[model samples]
Target: MSDIYDLITKRMDLLTREKEVFADNILRSSVPGEREKVIKFKNLVTHGGATPKAQATGLKSTNKNHLSLSTHLGSTRMTTKKTDSDVSLSGNTINAEDQLRKINDATTKYYEMTSLYQSYMRRHNTVITGR
Candidate 1:
């Protein structure tokens, strides 16, 4: 009877340790994923532009005189207007700045969770090793 009771208690302790280790692993793994998202969103917030390829094509034309001076000036004005409107529309539709903010918040939360997990692991190890 004592042998059976001891076996059951050891198994329960093993399972509890496994659960704690699994939770720590999950917290550790999630940090890198969140960091990647934070980097991607930061790039989008900093460098993402709303200008279309068609407008860029005009600027990259090989032929210098493909458009008359007046027409070129008009095109430039229109491109500026289009770019402004596209920026406003993108701000409304995608809200890259807000998305970046949320990503930053998530990254901070992940870091905190990982730090807590590390602290728990250190405490567990100390208890297990008696050092």
Candidate 2:
């Protein structure tokens, strides 16, 4: 079991380093690198994973996209709402909450992402160090 953990940890360590590099590339506004990082991180997270997310099911997606209730202007028809994504972490897909979260106190998403990252690092470290 420890040997398996060790092997996993080696791969995870490499993934972590890759993640850091990808993060730096994203920070520097490198789109291709950011995309590559997303793919690499996804592979690392899902490597030998047991369960599949709901969206990953073989059938068609059952989830429905929530439509915007936003009002329209004169001729402009304010349907196209765009906002700056400066507040969101690098590589996150943009959405309504991304903007509102930036405009308002959107702590849950940030907190959740932080907690997840911390947990990932903690587990990875524990597996590697065995302490």
Candidate 3:
């Protein structure tokens, strides 16, 4: 169980790094207008929530999952643009979006797993300590 915990922690750390990398790539690949649009979309998605100010801060989100919602929003926008036009999507943008999505999905899974492990540990400790 300790080994499993260690593995989960490592995976979570890796996912965090991966998410950051993808977010950076998405931001780098986006034009100024596209960036603005993505920020607006992200704000709308997270509107009236705890992180309403995320839009003004370089597309960062305050969500606990450590996944950057901006990347997903940008990806959606890129897909829409591609669909609206007859031209093929830029490979770099598509790849970055795909990577971001995969990283976000993995981050969510690892976060849930880590939470469950922590809960189990707390229960075990409570039984052992009888407190």
Count of steric clashes across candidates, in order: 0, 0, 0
Q: Rank the candidates by lDDT, best first.
A: 3, 2, 1
The true-versus-predicted C-alpha distance at residue 130 of model 1, in Å, is: 0.5
Clashes of 3: 0
Predicted candidate 3 versus true structure: per-residue lDDT over 50-76, tens digit per residue: 243354665665675777654432332
Clashes of 1: 0
Error of 1 at 95 (Å): 0.7
Q: What order do you get sorting by TM-score, best first?
A: 3, 1, 2
Q: After superposition, how far is residue 33 of candidate 3 from its true place, in Å?
A: 18
Compared with the true structure, what per-residue lDDT tens digits does model 1 show for residues 10-127? 4343333333333443344334222111112232233222123434454444575564322221221111011222233223222334444554555565556556556666887898
After superposition on all CA atoms, how large is the RMSD of candidate 1? 24.7
1 or 3, greater by TM-score: 3
Tens-place lDDT digits, model 2, residues 11-73: 444444434443443354434212222233343354333123322443232344532222011
List the candidates' TM-scores in order: 0.32, 0.24, 0.43
